[model samples]
Target: MSEALLIAVLALPAVGAAAAFFPDRAGRLFGTVLAALAFVASLLLGAYSQPASWFAYTPAAQGAPPIVPWTSVDTPWVPALDLRLHFGVDGVSYPLVVLTTLLTLLCCLYTLWHVPTGGRGSTLVALLLVVEVGMLGTFLALDLVLFFVFFEVVLLPMYAVIAGWGGERRRHAARKFALYTLFGSVLLLVGVFTVVAAAGTADLVTLTSGSVSLTRNTQLAAFALLAIAFAVKSPLWPLHTWLPDAHTQAPTVGSVLLAGVLLKMGTYGLIRVAVGVAPEGARWASPLLGALAVAAILVGCLVCLAQTELKRLIAYSSVGHMGFVLLGVATLTATGIQAALIGNVAHGIITGLLFFLAGAVKDRFHTGDLAVLGGLRERSPWLSGLLAFAAIASLGLPGLAGFWGEAFAVVAAFERGGAGWVTLGVLAAIGGALTAAYFLRMLRKVTHGAASPAVAAPPLPALRVSGMELVAWSPLVVLALLVGLVPAVVLGLSAAPVQSLVEAVTP
Candidate 1:
């Protein structure tokens, strides 16, 4: 039954992608329903994947394999290359899988009401479903070769979404986004084959479990290649130039998914693949990784402080937010990994809503320039309130979803101990302050004071929030509060798997 659910979670989105081309509104309606069903399947998969014995299960013996999927489907796909149709769900991946489905569903529902000008709503929905399939497959794939296949699958569909349904500069943004990620894809391909060839197996479970021994040199090389590849996707530091452009020009749903689950792919792979597959490499590179992560935090916040465009500010914020996630992973401790995991989920929730609100602002005012927007509270109280809530949540308010991840990442870095790690931790905490400053700056400019020309130009009635917007934004708002208040929602599920992985990797 669990296996069937796993298969269904994947199949539903795929079917929706095909059905989404079936004529007019019917296609969109069908797609939304299918997305909803896919989300339901993901939730059920989580429920079923939990062990029946739960508290009674014992830890694996020392030097034994750590990866034990609660539910998995293993079958031969290509006997010649030793590749198999291997997929599984466990504590580590389940939350991300569920996140992908939920975000896709919200995006689809948003599309049903307001299709961007560049293409048909049906096509946009179809492409979203395709992206969903790739993301879910990435999270669920347990074979190294298969993981690469799914990872590559996301590039074109997302490109189509941006290029076909995006803003004035969409084509250039789409092209740059594709080219940067494709470069990373090449590195990823080389890294995957390197590990597979050296280890004589493509099974991620086998490779990560310490059953296959890789020399230090090979592990170092593979980890570097994989880390850079994932970093490009995470858009870490110098490699992140493409992201602001992509987000600035992408349609609302495109920005949401890009910031939401798409970026998580990189950080997720860094943890599950790079760190898990090459612990020695991770240890060797920890200082460098942590340093770059803090750099991203500070740089992203500084850029956001100077940003003039609304969407662009939000885009830059993702860089800093993801920096926190990466910093947590760089620590290489159970607490750090747990912080990274919850941070991943919290960023998805808060940033997704921010993009949604940014899109609404752009759509209504016909401008995203912070200099030209003001007095949101006077013209549209509810919209202003939602924007305020999203911005506050994004700035890492103590009781909001964004708080735990950033705060814990700092705590984890301190927990690691050492002058350099301690410095990185202090700098990251300062970045947290910078985060609050920029977000508050954004809110004051966009929501308070006298009305700017752009804000005053839009009729008050026109600024009123639509029902469709409410439906799309409500879940994100609730999730920000829920996850913030009860961080255990993500942490509880991941604790054991994270402990096992940390133990396996620790010298």
Candidate 2:
């Protein structure tokens, strides 16, 4: 039953993608309906799915407990190489799966009212569905080769979306995006193969369970490969140059999904693949990872302060926000991993809202330049109000969803036990202050000022918030508030799995 649900969650979007070849209205309807069904299916699976193994495997060591994959599905696809089709979701993966489906559904709903300026609405929807398949499959996949296949599957469709439908510089951004991530893919492939060669199997569950003993040196080398790959995707500071370009160039829905589900893939990989399978390597690398995370936080915040374009600023903010997530992972404590998990979801919800608002602003003013976007409050109260709300939430205000992740990450870092981590924690807290500074500056510039000449000039179509826009954004707002008020909602889901993961490495 669980495997069937997982398959439905994975397959429905694919089927919708196929069905999207129909004419525009029909295709949009079909795509949205299918995405909605997948969302429901994901929720049901998370609520009721139990731990169970779909494939029979006897432990190599006598008296060892059998390893069961939650909501697992397995099938033999290769014999000689021992690769197989395996998929499952644990406590850690389930919320992200739900998040992916929810955001995809909202994007599809938004399309119903506003397709990109391009004519091929059907093709656009199909590309989104394809990206959904890749994201969902990545989170659910339990085999290394299968995970890589799903991971790579996300690249081309996204590139097509950007190149085919993005802004003036779309072509360059798309090409750069493809080149960077593909290069990262190469590193990931090498790491996957290295681990497979050492373990003699590609089963993620078994390898992470410590069934395959890996020496410290091998773990470090393999982890380095994997880290570089995931970092490009998670886009830790130096590797992050491609992201602002990609986000700024991509269309509204494209930016929404890119911020929402796509970025989580990298941090998810760090937890699920890099750290899960190579704890010793993780321990060795935690300091470096934490340092890089701090750099991302500081750098991303400072970049935001200097940005002229709203979307570009949001893009850079993701770099800083994800830094918090990465820092949580680097802490290597139970609370830290849990903080990373919630932070992943929080960044998704909060940043997705920010990008959506940024797109709306661009749509209204025909510009993303903050210099010309003043007096949003005078021109459109609805838009300005929402923008203010999202920006405040983003600044890690005490009761909002953003606060818990960074706060806990700082706490975890302080408690991570080492002089170096204590220093990192202090730096991270300073980064949080920088986060507030930039966001407050942005809010003042965009929402609180008199209308600039460009904004005072009448909107092209008498700009007002549409019903469809509200429909798309309402969930993000509510979830951000929900998670903020009751963080336990997200924190609870990953606690046990994170505890177990911490145990795996604690020795």
Candidate 3:
């Protein structure tokens, strides 16, 4: 039964996390095997599993529909107010659950040989496995309290990775990252409690099935708390200050996963929790959200043009890319919503690759400073080629995975069923142009240049790209090409769900 799959999907990495603490070299091998199995399982789930099986999870409530959670697993640890151990998965969660599993496995595989953690490779691998549990649970939990528990569970491990295993400023970055996310977590907790207190059920499925009404004031207030929490996680615009520092400081695998998968949690929360549960509030706030998105895109693009540090430039690019996701949500249309979804996946893969190459560049030449690091193309052609490909992809080059998300987002913005959305579309188009310009400039400086004297002069042999590194990275690159060359794969999955969401939100 699919229920069994769910248990394995979550439990497998967890089991690995535990085994990974065995304090031996086999810890890495054990973790790799477990992670690989989970990744394969996730692929099976996404490619072949039926939605009927996925929605086996049904939330319990008095006003709910007749269908029950056919295969839920719960344990009663508290009965005073009806909170207990609860776990489930549903249609809305299908893609994310699979993504979390797939990427975590890749991260585990990547860390096995290429990690830069402070002589604590096994411990770092264990932490990532633990982080996987929190990620999977966050996407699948039906109960509000359970969701929050999983949501907050990821904080400490990530903090340790950034602070304990990070670069020179790791500790400072860790502190700042913890403080920012914790601030958002507080707001999210308040919002979750408000929902439970008012609606009397922490069950998301039940809330989705029926209608719940609250006054405008309460809706707005609760919306702020929930949206801010998601936004901080998404690291949208002003609250986005934490991400660049975190990315700049974390190791390559950490940066790849952080940029690729972790940030999607925030946007996923925006759609799954904020808009899905708080439609009225979402409608009220659409205009303002649109404006902030536009500002982020513009600001993110402008800042990228000024960056001499390669990683920081891409870090800022995340700010711009997420602006598109917010813009899609602000529109509240099927097309716009789908654009956001596709954009989320695209950015994760493309930017994740970018970080990978950035780290590789650092590892090769000993600096990500664009100034000192000239002629990587000559010194290391393979690294140069990979960086170029990812750079083009990140800038939304046509016929690649990045193009569709930005292109349609602009189209949706123009026809986003409102004047506000139209404005966002225009601003985003400008951001797109800026994206192209900055990336072209970046390519010139890093990947396509005359070698410095050292690079041009003889005796220094070019750095070699390893086989395992290729295995670790090529999947994302291939996907970026697949989605770009054949966007239908992504579009087909998102179209129906987005249609449902847009119909619900449209006035």
Q: After superposition, how far is residue 327 of candidate 3 from its true place, in Å?
A: 0.4
Q: Provide the TM-score for each candidate, comma-separated.
A: 0.98, 0.95, 0.92
TM-score of 2: 0.95
**Clashing pairs in model 2, backbone N/Cα/C closer than 3 A:** none
Q: Give the TM-score of candidate 1.
A: 0.98
Model 3 residue 40 lDDT score: 76
RMSD of 1: 1.7
The alpha-carbon lDDT assigned to residue 355 of candidate 3 equals 89
Global CA lDDT of candidate 2, please?
A: 0.88
Q: In model 3, where do residues sit more than 4 Å from their true spots? A: 51-79, 84-91, 453-462
Residues 352-375, candidate 3, lDDT per residue (tens digit)?
889888887777666788776677
Shift in Å, residue 396, candidate 3: 1.2
Which scores higher on TM-score, 2 or 3? 2
Report the Cα RMSD per candidate.
1.7, 3.8, 3.8
**Ten-residue segment with the worst summed lDDT in candidate 1?**
51-60
Model 3 RMSD vs true structure: 3.8
Q: What does candidate 2's lDDT look like per residue over 1-507, in tens digits?
A: 777898999999999997557988888888889999999999878766843331222222332212345678889979777889999887688889989999999988988887777557777888999999999999999999999999999999999999988999999999999999999999999999999998888998898887789999999999999999999998888899999999999999999999889999999999999998888999889899999999999999999999999999999999999999999999999778888898899888988889888988887779999887788788889989999899989889988889888889999999887898999999999999999999988888898878888788876356689999999999999999999998877766566567677877776
Candidate 1 C-alpha lDDT tens digits along 124-159: 899999999999999999999999999989999999
